[model samples]
Target chain A: MLEHVVNGLVLGGTYALVAMGLTIQYGIARIMNLSFGDTIIAACFATYVLFSVFAINPILALLIVGPTGYVFNLLIYRFIMKPLVARAPDEGALEVDSILVTFGLLFVIQGVLLVMFGGGYTSYSFLNSPVSMLGTVVAGNRLVALVLSLTFGAVLVGVLYRTRWGMILRAVATAPQSAPLFGIDTNRAARTAFAVGGALAATGGGVVSMFQTFTATAGVVFTMKALIVVILGGKGSVPGAIVAGLLLGLVETFVAAYIDPGLTLAAVYTVFLVLLLVRPNGLFGKA
Target chain B: MTMKTSHAFLLAAAVLALLAAAPLLIPDYWTGVLLGMTGYVTLATAWAMFSGPTRYVSLATVAFFGVGAYTVAVLNETLPYPLVLLCAGGIGMVMALIVGFSTLRLAGVYFVIFTFGLAELVRQTVSWWEVNITYTMGRYVFLPFEGRHIYWQLLALAAATFLISWGIGRSRIGLALKALGDDETVAAHAGVDVTRIKLLLFVISSTIITLVGAIQAPRWTYIEPSIVFNPTVSFMTLIMALLGGAMRLWGPLVGAIPLFLLFEWLSVSFPDHFSIILGLLFILIVFVMPEGVLAKIETLRKGSPK
Candidate 1:
């Protein structure tokens, strides 16, 4: 049971990082990139190659993978999102169009990765040793991941909440119409947020690849997982997303441990679906 | 603002007639491709009818499609195909009713997520039931129809879907939906039955999709949770709808041909890389013609200055 909690936290941390990135993108940028999963998967594959093939440490590979992801997402924002941002007259239209755009982008990225990697499962040989902790054994990579996820989550929350840049960002997110009145470079800020979201997502993905095996085809499931986290945590709340991610990771871990593996995802999502009817905003969500 | 339903009907009839005879006209290998295209055309057109009007992006393709497939999978031995089709449609309608009522009140993103999570629920349930009760990985299916018959059947399904979409595109309900899509609160204040319209359209679209899944299920030698409840198939249907442009009734059809052909060719030639190329195409579409091909054409025709 204690072991499940530890594992859940590790899973939760990963979920929080991924969902936090999504939350930032959606809450502030007013655009939800459905390709968040593919972005993670892309980073994971990159990590797999760097760590497994090139004999680099997975942590070190984050330096290479994270920036690449940031640039890639910035390009996505520039070419794809920027055009739509101008084209859509209202927030709702932008949401609808951006979802489609990201769906299209997901396929494109998945296709490229599938071509390059051939959809084979790849892994990073990292942190093989297990540490004994309170009658439960945890892998070295997962321990690193928990600390890293917490650290990054703190860094993001700190930046978003405690910093001056975060103040301008929050202004743009809450009232884009008035942000311009206040002389905030709303577009540039949004682009920067997206880049940051990408970097965070890649870092989380590299960590996850260190712990679990993944493939290009893993994109959709991961995407859904991230969506579940964000929804469970609330759409735009960073702390909410983090807490929700942890809750989901716990729920999933317990269910997997206690029930049939095949029944795990079905049970979790069905319950979440029903729960949505009662508290549509999620547990820690503003509503 | 555009063509009347009657005119669209006449145009559709001509196209359907040509499509009905397409197996004879096209090369033999392409018959399989044409058949698949019709399947996508059916799903995409119907999907657009519901989602396009409200601007609600539903990711629940497999949920409706699986209803029909699962209905047949479980009951094909006991029930006739016609009965199975009815039950499939009814099941899909009920599912949509339940899902819509629960989700329609939530924000737009909630709807998308719920629709997506729905497939996960259904797939896992079916697979679990299959393993525990059905005692099999998949069920063998034997439909008393040749390849061409199935081809025509799929074509007829596409034609029917197109007709319904065309009818809906011109109807008062369609106008209300477009109003709602433009601004839900205004539409509600304007006395449009927002929830009812969304629910009705959702049920209607899902029923047609359910029927298509049932019709297509028999062509497979074996049926399982994976094939019937394939999310990729659902997403591709949605993407194709967008790729064609969901605003107009005929947009998805316009989008279906190239997408289906490319999908078939790539899956056959470079199975792994085709999705990448398709994705590239999708991106190009969004970049070059975000409104869809038909919209792009209209812009060109009007010589609209950006």
Candidate 2:
């Protein structure tokens, strides 16, 4: 149905937004960042509190949450991730170390959140009114979220593709060994990219809070979903994230609507497995 | 055997004999706690057997484990206990073979996530089937296993896991795996059958994990997808193995006993803050001793010349 299509796009938009952040971190910074979802969930809870207690609009909360995410991620990079980065014998060692470290970080953030928020599902009504679009009625907040997601995605793509800073980042990501030869501060680029990715995750969380119910423990679900999108989109490609995110959303929506709803997760994994088996490098990934 | 080897063997036999008699000497409450410790020790030891040398860091420990638990849960009533255990092992082996062949080619982050995804996929599929076909959320495990019986079973399994790990470390496959872990392409060039060694080790590790799950399932009384397929099991096994020094045969045992005790104490004293403490410990462990406690000890010993 047309309604399902609209819903899928809204879901896919958030997926793309989060996947972009993760791709940026993994592709450029070379940190697997299992805690990325906890950051997103933290932003969601932050937006919730701001909206409920301070009476700030969710859109306005983005201004506060996004920068906090950037700063928090930067601090984590400086404090926690720096040592692992320093002693890594090779890229493979770094990957293993990052995965273990971030996996620990995931529990740390989740534990703090659980302590602060009593392990309950939290959602607040925001822009609940439905608006007619095309031949279908859609929630006002989801539509706004989609538009915001697209706008952010577009701006990021433009920055990455059309700017010198983006060029340096791309060069570092593609060839870390040779980036130093070109006078690019690969370390600085990696830190900034990781922080920016955190900002995007926070922004995505704010967008999601407008329409979704979330729990402190649900961060892993978002992490897994974003991971799937990132890998499917080709690890570091922004445009690929957009396409793959939307594709996953559509597939999930369609499977839920046409088949049994309980099979949605299974369906997503099926698509991911088949794609991985077929193209280990992903659709747009470089070998 | 060498004199030192025979001495080590005698020491091990004496310790195991003491452990076998522990249940009769200890109170019922402590027997329960020891049972939990043995279970984790078995799982952790099996996990390190493959992950340590290969550096593959599999997160699918629960996948095979859950399969083993589910197999027993379904077949226990129809079949005898030993038969159910055999079936569980058989099913786990087949699944491991399928998963290993398909996925051993991918390494690093890709393999890690793939195993994780595979576990989640199995969990979701089982959950769906239970809801739609079985019309039940969980199954009752009515095995007549006492605390001591399960503990002894797990203890035996843990011993077997250690023996297998020790044997493998001395085998040609172990050397090949070590080479592959250092660099896959070079190992391949050096005529190591990279895929076969990986598959063999992976299957062995996974089958042991499956048996552990089967042995431990009776203690739960009720089993479900959420309980059996909990990702925490995977994470905990990885942490314990790595914390002890996965590369060493006895490292998992060294890691599991202390961490298990710490967790038990944390949960009892500060139930609400248990997760927070756990997280901090994990972070501290990885940050301070990424190579693990044994490795840290080795460095200290080297620094302090005897």
Please give, for residues B154-231, the per-residue lDDT of candidate 2 as tens digits: 889888887888788878988887898778999999999988898899899999999999999998889998889887
Error at B93, model 1, angstroms: 2.2
TM-score of 1: 0.92
Report iRMS values in order: 1.8, 1.6
TM-score of chain B of each: 0.92, 0.95
lDDT for each residue of candidate 2 in A121-155, tens digit (9 for 90 to 100): 99999999999998999999999999999999999
Cα lDDT tens digits for candidate 1, B206-250: 888888887777778688887788767877787788878988877
Worst 10 residues of 2 chain B by lDDT: B1-10
- lDDT measured at residue A41 in model 1 versus the true structure, 0 to 100: 94
**DockQ for each numbered candidate:** 0.61, 0.64
Highest TM-score model number = 2
Lowest lDDT 10-residue stretch of candidate 1 chain A? A266-275
Native A-B contacts reproduced, model 2: 0.55
DockQ of candidate 2 compared with the true complex: 0.64
